[model samples]
Target: MGKNRLQLENHLFILPDYLNHPFISGNKLRKLKYNVLEAKKQKKETLLTFGGAYSNHIAAVAYAGKEYGFKTVGVIRGEELADSISQNPTLTFAQNCGMEFKFVSREQYRNKNNPLFLNQLKEAFHNIYVLPEGGTNALAVKGCEEILEEADAKFDYICCPVGTGGTISGLINSSFKHQKIIGFPALKGDFLNKEITKFAAKTNWELNLDYHFGGYAKVTDALIAFINTFKLQYNIPLDPIYTGKMMFGICDMIQKGYFDENAKILAVHTGGLQGIAGMNTVLKQQNKPLIV
Candidate 1:
């Protein structure tokens, strides 16, 4: 992506979060930095994680685990995905990275954190380093806090897409009082406030809940069009699950006079471009325009 690609206005700067390694890019790398170390310290050889089908977290964790010499097991949410794993790009990538799958029904997945469910897993797989869904834990939050550097202090607004709240909570903690952290949630709900508040220690942040388009993993023609145009103009790839929605929300807010005219906003591109191929697969199945 060119430096001037995201020049929607003089006030906004887009940080291309996917320019790093093909795997472990953006906030995923930030969230995993500490967890991997702790797993090492604990002498864990197996990493067991949870995610829905086509989860970016799943792909990242699988790759990270492979690179770090750990046996990776993903407890996937949909049992139906078990037979179709070969067709799903995200799951296929994780599988190719040496991640084994334990697909359970949606009902069983609802109890993913239940003690009984965990005890059952303990019996099934010993020495497992468990990571929760979306990899949002205290260690993950601590890792996320390092995303902003000293040079980022000049920006008036720090923007990022909200997934499991760990990333935005980190942004909120690291941001200065004068620099408000703005999160555009990819899911439609006020429920994330409680999750974010669990780790956020500052008040210089708020959520724009109107930009989910539909809901988690949902997309509209307008959103698809916007994403396509954005890539064409910016030469940046954004996944539909997170960063795409945030960028749309930021642009819509700016257009609606939601921010101060002089406010300088830096949008953190929390990388999920890996999920785009899977997302486009879904779009094609639905007869929708593919994300260009």
Candidate 2:
């Protein structure tokens, strides 16, 4: 089958078909494929994972669990929910997908690898499979390998937003000999480069971490306006948490003459469209218009 078309300013090209699956879409779907298969190999009946209130990983795990007939448990990193309470949109979506939720204190949650924690969870739910936050595991890396294979042509530069660094790491690992991979981090922190280096060291490719803009989950008015303008011009949706920052960084670098005109850049649009819901609150709090 041919690649899907996405019209962008000054050019039109085929975009990867990441929306074919209802629950399994975008980068999350790409990362979860092998994780699910590995779970099956281990004969695990339940899939347990960790994430914040609006984590895409949590939503994907919930959807995958229900789709594959496995029980799912989400260990939330925050305060406990009261009975008969209304949930946030993300949590509501997960509940509708038949995933169980468990709230835990931030301190206790940090001990995710402690035997006592695993044992307690095992006793509560037998035959469980534990997936790391954002599904950043070796199995997820294997699944991400499929992304590089899906690219229609070789590119000089491959760009993607870095969150936990799993997706970008996978892209770097799967890069062709001549391709250079760069990760635009969405979070601000000194440790991101270190993390990327650690992951990249395991692979044959190196990662460039200079395009984070600000930091992870950190959005400025300029970034928001840029995202709005791009949507108006391209009519393609981008979540501020990742893809938006990636596009912003790419455009900035291009204008600054970082890329040669002959260089072909491939930007991975890792979908997290559900994150749009949170933008309403941010805009209202900032007294900004909802529309571009």
Would you estimate the TM-scores of all the predictions?
Answer: 0.96, 0.88
**lDDT for every model?**
0.88, 0.74
Model 2 regions lying over 4 Å from their true place: 5-17, 80-87, 150-153, 197-214
Q: lDDT tens digits, residues 100-136, model 2?
A: 9888889988988788998898899889999888888
Best by lDDT: 1
Candidate 2: give the clashing pairs: 186-215, 186-216, 187-215, 187-216, 188-215, 188-216
Model 1 agreement with the true structure over 201-265: per-residue lDDT tens digits: 99888998898888999998888898989889877777888988999999988999988998888
Clashes of 2: 6
| Model 2 score (lDDT) | 0.74
